[model samples]
Target chain A: MKDLTTENITENVHAINSQCQNPRTRYIFERLVSHLHDFARETRLSTDEWMTGLDFLTDVGTISTDLRREMILLSDTLGLSALVDSIDHPRTGKSTEGTVLGPFHTHDAKEVENGYAIHKDPDGTPLLVLCTVKDTEGNPLGGVQIDVWEGDSHGNYDVQYPERDGPDGRGILFSEQDGTFWFKAVKPVSYPIPMDGPVFNMLQMLGRHPNRPGHVHFLLRKDSFDPLITALYPRGDPYESSDPVFGVKESLIVDLSEVTDPEMAKKYDVKEGTSLLTYDFVLVSTRETLKLRKEKAEEAIKKMGRSMEDFQGLPILDVD
Target chain B: MKDLTTENITENVHAINSQCQNPRTRYIFERLVSHLHDFARETRLSTDEWMTGLDFLTDVGTISTDLRREMILLSDTLGLSALVDSIDHPRTGKSTEGTVLGPFHTHDAKEVENGYAIHKDPDGTPLLVLCTVKDTEGNPLGGVQIDVWEGDSHGNYDVQYPERDGPDGRGILFSEQDGTFWFKAVKPVSYPIPMDGPVFNMLQMLGRHPNRPGHVHFLLRKDSFDPLITALYPRGDPYESSDPVFGVKESLIVDLSEVTDPEMAKKYDVKEGTSLLTYDFVLVSTRETLKLRKEKAEEAIKKMGRSMEDFQGLPILDVD
Candidate 1:
């Protein structure tokens, strides 16, 4: 056996792991090992530094629970989540862009009706969220399910509070016959991510802030259309320029106008001068999304000098 | 702020972290983010795949304890530990090559004398460990401390058993006036790494076996001399060519000759036909090790287009 040196270690690792039964898995790990080895070599990473990194990772995992996923938080702050989302959900022509689902999302949110109040108690400025669901051809789509969630004025999600009896600042609602959806909820305020976790420590080490911009997360689904996981950042939030998670996209940033008209407040069942966030979401059909993604996957496979026949069993897109 | 995309996310992540006060940390993270993002792009990493990776990492951290470090196991299986050790401890002249310190080394080993029997119970083939400590110039160096440990015939260490126990198959000894040391210990048997952890699951996914070759760990230290942490693999072990941790080195592999002479067996206080393994360890002075490491560090910094002055605060080498 050839002695493992810095120069041969990378290839040796690859060769050892080259026998993975799944082509997709083997491909992913092959690239991962290559980049990981290159990173170590380029940095000439010291043993102490490596130990410190492992300690940080352990802390992150230790602090994680079913309610909070710190591993996802780590991926977010490192810009990895954003990059993956952008790659997997590349924008179709005029389609709404996708972003991270974030660690705060929960499947137990209450299903409410259009114009229903999602916030349990008034803890911040009253707001009206108005959205329209449309197709790539700008045609209205009814019966679309839109899940909305955000942190309260105190910058805490319902899950963050141990005494949370029910979901607050979050709810699931459907579009009306006109493809228009409106609801009453509190405006999302900029807040720091959980500071007790290792991700916060990493941000501190980087001399970066730990706050995500004020934004309302939305997960939209409809029959025959691609599901969109996204968030709408309020324009001009203090942390907008420096969202540590890098979840903000230019297209996802929308204006939060304060409507002083009493008539408008009465119509939306909110106090006068409440903030208003309105945007139209365009979603692509599953057929179009799958085609595009499959093409991209094939391109990637070709780039690696592999044949599509070898990876036919792998799911290129989760959508079907 | 520029919207993060696959093409620009790397630089944007770097820019967000550019304010790090420590130059060394900034440099390391700069390379890390660059490579991490490149890997994601190269793989076109999917969200599901990313989530799977995160889950694996969480499992690794969750299974770790003060007694067992799955993170180090993961690093070792990936050949990262071996690469770092090779880079950090390059051989100088005839000085013995260093390998991974491994996670098995403990600070609580009992100190004994030359020709002492370190094993608690006779459970395997009788063997005599004979070694001489010398300087790089080939001069004998007395009073050098050598810490030795290995698994028993059952392929398990003392720590692997939860039952109450003291140190077994491990001890600390010093070279005598003539720079020669000998000890009686059980022959090491090839063993798989802990197979109950996520690392083992990963190995299975990679279609790779987990066994490391039969080897005994040795850590040698003397005042003013650079410490050596390495292992001697018995020649002809079945797993030598494919050690999962990549810890084997050609120079560190040695033969185990059977000594059948009754007189020699009596001299070493072992049974007739005991196995004899002998070698000399050459150590470099701390001054020389530091000099070589600093030169390499400087060259690495220059390669990154950085100046050594910017990282003077960072400890380049653990050795003084």
Candidate 2:
């Protein structure tokens, strides 16, 4: 009887793992089975508790949609995202640190000219953002595409606003020939995650808070270089010490130092007296094939018995 | 930082277990964390893969309802239900052996008189069900409630029929003072699980079938005794070797010996020369609290931040 039970769990795990067709997926599924079985044995988990866990997971999927990536958010809030990111992008030297992309990034940002303001309802706190892209040796990488987005003072993204459109607080800009990029956007304010879902309820039940510090989203890419997807959090926000997603990285934390020099503001096309914040990004050369990543994703979907058409325009950030 | 990750997972596990409000729950949660962390470290699970698993679980919750019991079905199919039953019951010589309750048993089966046919459609071959409830020392338990349900010749339960109601294929009877119970229900046929949902898809992906052998559901209870929830399957069926739920136990298997005696058939209220199936159920007495086990369901819901109110009327099986 004991042998039978062991064989049963092993067989089920093998069956579930074999469903994956891709190497990465197969790797993951194989790991999941071993862990799941190990868990069963170690915990002597009851049928009722396992079923309850299954029920909980089911809710995670139901709450997810194009706009809400509950599953990804769950992963993020659980530190799985950071763990994966850390493994995939091992920090070697001066390469830009990779952080969570978060769930608010949209693909339809309007291309804005250098020094153009992306914020629609600027709250009169004039600010300028200047970024420079360079290689390990400090040589500027001109014409790099830099996508930028941030939350408003009220800690909500443009997409979260029902009446907004066309990237109200988002922009894409190209670096100048000297590898310098400048854009005008409001200073991002700290925000709390959507606390209405199961994630929120879990936090409440555990006596944890759900606040992420003030941060700006960026996805920078250039020819022959690794695509960098990350976020920059202000150095000094109370919640910075306890980001709900565990997204904060020492290298990515930038000081939004108050700049009062009028000449420095004028150089960035901001009003003479406006404040300014500056940060530089260093990128590494792309060594892996992007096509491989895309194929891995497609293979995962096929293994899941789904088609790309089923997920078209569905929000992918919730799983970020 | 590394220590922090370990601590976070540990604390989360504790939080989940604490929500269970039972020793069994706490035991299971602690075990689950050890296994989960081991799996994470062993496979270096990627963010995407972790998120996908979460997505699969979420779907399980969405598909579950008061009627379907997808989570219970999941547990049954995965063999966790049987493992749990074995642990809780432990085959004490004095108590009746327990099996999975399955998803079809409903509340308040129609009370049928002794020797009445429970099957409405008698087009199939007729079989008589004879059962006796005895204590370990062969003493009978009188006034015991014996609730029974079975599938039709087509291998479908009455509840599976949208137009049927009021226990079309279910019967409730009280044991005689001598601790003997007898009834007549249809000869059940083997059937497959519902071939939709993630569970079905998972089975198909794993190259496994969803067939379960013919069986009859029984819930026997008497005052001051451990209520027995079990199922009895015909001794011979091709799928008996691979019951999808692993619900078949050696003690629960009974032979349906062919009987051609007209006198015997007439005495049992069956048409002349009908077949007979004789089986007995032995129950042990205990005081284990058997209130419905909700498991870690609330933690799951809170973690996903989804409301359960939106999902009503969906069947959620409780396999004991």
Candidate 3:
């Protein structure tokens, strides 16, 4: 009789592997199975532990809704989102590094002009954000689109608040003809992720905190160049290097300086604030395709993290 | 600046690891993060591919309900359930092997005496199952409780059908003083698992069928002995070796011979049945503790896959 040893599990894995019609799917499933079996062995996981893990995942799923996605949050806290980001947006010296697309980026925010008030909440310190989108060689590229979002003064996203279906602390902005854009907003602050669910329970059980560093999430793109996803971390945040999601990168951290230029304050419409945020996005054509360079880019464009049916493509500029 | 390379992901992993309060939780999370990172690197997954994976998991969670758990089934079809089974229920030459506790066991099935009709559908051939529960030393332990369940002749469980709140092709039977029990039912047949959701779509995409070997699930227990969970597979089934869940074992397979004796048929109250299924369950106490396995056996007694407020323990025997 064939026994149920570790070796036989490998044999079964191979048996299932052979049945996969898609080669990439087969590769992924085999690796997943092997790692899972190894994890079980490494932990010598008992029945209760196994059940606990299953229950945890079930609870994560059960709480998922149109407004909240616990699964992605699970992935984030587990450091999976960071790993996938590293793989997809590899450290090529030229392009900006990409980070996770946290489950708060919505598509309802229309494209605002170069200078718009992104954080209109009256409680937090007003800060101005000025960014110049450019190619790697320092050539200014106008009409670049950047989807920006961050929590308000209370450290909760627009969606986190009830009766707030549209973006208040989020916006879509296009660079000017000179490839420079600016906006007014509250300086984003560090915040703990939702800690009321099983994911948080697991973190608490592990003695870990659920805090993410303060940052503004930006999805920047221009046609013919690859998209760059990065969170502009407030420089000197305590959790910058110790983010629970492992999303910190030294290059992505930017410190905002207090700008007192009277003329500049009037230009950006942040009359009430003393300081502003400034960061320029340097874009490049990594020429990297999606899904292991095998899948069509369009295939990925549609599946991106938004319920918005139409992704407004890059605006065509007179000068390429 | 440190780049977002595999090395940096490791750095991020370390950053998160430093905050873990519990050593065991840290170990598990670190290993999980490391393996997940490695998987991403080995696959060089793209953004779109990553999104697809996330969406697949989200869909799995979206469909989960009181009646179905697609996440556990996903684990089963991928052989994770089997690996966990083998880990938690290791290969001991003395006891029966354990398999999955499929999401169908209900506490509604009352404990019946010997020679009960589990399958009351009245459409299929009658099956008379006779079994004896014994310890490793061949000692007949009287008053063994065995919870049995199986799909009906249509290859569906009562729960899978509408409005069937309790078990029909299921029973909780008490053994006679000689440690034997008999039940009448339809000979269970091999059937495909529920395949109308994302789990089935994954199997289909992998070119794998959703068939499980035909078997009767049994959860047997006595007061002092360790519990035994197993499935008695009918011999000669087409999907025996290729069970999609990878749950087949030669020792668990048994063939029921045809018994034409009118006298024996009358004894079990099954008239003119051509086949008789007999399998003696050798349930040795491979003692195991729970997660908080330190709990007395009584704690586990009530929570064995039932939604009951109380677990009716083993029927008191005449002699302890």
Candidate 4:
């Protein structure tokens, strides 16, 4: 006798736990049902507004492609992406913080030596980035691979271009034994998200700006430290104060200092007028012994009845 | 300085109200962003779990076509469909209760006189349904149009069949001077929702049944009273106690009484083996004067910038 009452809706939908083998999956959906129903009731949402929401989600799917993921964009715009990231990689303050793995991350980007330029299209002013990778106690963590990507001066990712073949303004750089890595790229600029679709239409209708402030994406890895996915925003864009995606962290912001010295330019192998961005990544202690983490992740995977082979490359906490 | 922190995610996304031209839209989305983020944090949703959700929604879109609206089904499965309907059409206990206007409703149903049969391609026992339409005070509301539709004995709507055209097990009937009508249709059989897509996949994973108990869909209209959309569930079906969509209303459930008298069957033009389904629809008083409602709906539509012509047949709340 559930008569479509808001009071009973959440309870009824949450009763689907009769056979879910995965406790985690059931837990997630139970909360999802509760929260979604609560949101509708709290807002006293109208029929037309609910229809609009469905239509908006449909449009998000319609506009998604290999280059653009409207779902990620939607998650980012609404801060759900960042919120989930924060939950998984909680702020222990003992490690380099993690950020959202935006839809732009792809595999097999051209690996370059330290101090190489990733700005292939050359759409922005030249800049030299100098970064240091270290363990929690400030010891240099040498030979770690750092995969980096960012928007160009015009605030566009290489994949955003229709004619793109390989990654541009994106690279994988191996840090020196001294835990220092430097590279060349364009100055970051804030840009609007794709507004031609339904997500943006809703955003526009909501009186919200669709701009994401500029930043460089870094995916760092060593045998021990958990993969530290972080981003560095240029210190002072208007969007820095109000990033549409809530991506900016005060600790992650790096100031751009103008360096006119020719000697410094030669040492860094960059133009004399290049701006310098110096930041350091501090890795957290892998508290659980590497073997222990692997064993746990493997056991969890097996318990879920999924074969390891099918879950390859699925962030299994490598010990190598 | 929002570095994917859970604390600021809600605030950051809720800031999308700067440009929303529609006040109501902004209010709705602001609440949506808040609850979605809170849910992720409360559940500590894993990255893979979030990705699964995105994939699920994407599949929902991929499976949806002109005929199939998996999004609505997803909403229904989650109880969102029932929740929103209840919000819009609250139960005042004065009129016939409404239920989920399931995705099967269509236009251009064959119009028939009283006592006409709606079951065109019957696969089970035939039945005669006698229905009366009236106002809340029990006065006959004659000459109103009542569109009745239901799944056949197989629990399949005509729209679900690719080879079907027009409507079967569905018809539009006008109430006589006594506000009474009757139609012929097969007995409703409980059926599972389509399980070929991600929605049903998740349902199975959660160990939840996808069956919607047997019921008939009715949409009635008149010039004075507000249009009423309702559903009638057959009593004694196991799913009646646990409709997957939470659509069963106690006030809407009716039992089919056995008809044993031979003389009455012949007078009603029904066979001896036929069952009888008798129910009455009581319309609510159009509390607001007719002219006031029409003017308000029209004014609101115009203010929203949609032309009256484009929104014709869009529930103008006419009083004429």
- Which candidate tops lDDT? 1
CA shift of B82, model 3, Å: 1.4
Report how far residue A108 has shifted in candidate 4, in Å: 5.8
The residue pairs found clashing in candidate 3 are A128-A276, A128-A277, A207-B21, A291-B46, B290-B293
Candidate 3: which docking quality band? Answer: acceptable
State how far residue A179 of model 3 sits from its true place (Å): 1.0
Candidate 3, B158-195: lDDT as tens digits: 87888876669989998888988988878888888887
Predictions in order: lDDT: 0.82, 0.67, 0.71, 0.74
Candidate 3 lDDT for residue A168: 91
Docking class of 4: acceptable
The TM-scores that each candidate's chain B achieves against the reference are: 0.90, 0.81, 0.83, 0.84
Is model 2 an incorrect, acceptable, medium or high docking prediction? incorrect
Interface RMS for model 3: 9.4
Individual DockQ of the candidates? Answer: 0.54, 0.21, 0.29, 0.36
Evaluate model 2: give its TM-score: 0.76
**What is the descending lDDT order?**
1, 4, 3, 2
What tens-digit string does per-residue lDDT give for candidate 1 at A1-320?
Answer: 35887878899888888877777788778778888887777667777788898888887877888778899999988889988887777677599999888999987898898898877766677788988999999999999999999888888899999898878888899998788999887788899999888889899999999888888899999989878999998888888888899888889999889868888777778777778999999988988876776677667666656555424433322212
How well does candidate 1 score on lDDT at residue A69?
89
Sorted by TM-score, highest first, which candidate order results?
1, 3, 4, 2
Q: What local lDDT score does residue A303 receive in model 3, on the 0 to 100 scale?
A: 38
Report the alpha-carbon TM-score of model 3 versus the true structure: 0.87
What's model 2's lDDT at A58? 63
The candidate scoring highest on DockQ is: 1
Task: Encode model 2's per-residue lDDT on A1-320: one tens digit a residue.
Answer: 21234336556545534554444445445555566655554443454555567666666767776666777777676566665555434444576777877777778888888888888765736568888999877899999999998888788888777776557778999999999998877777788888778777655644567888988888898889867878887677888767777788777788776556777765776666565668888887655423333344454445545433212211111122
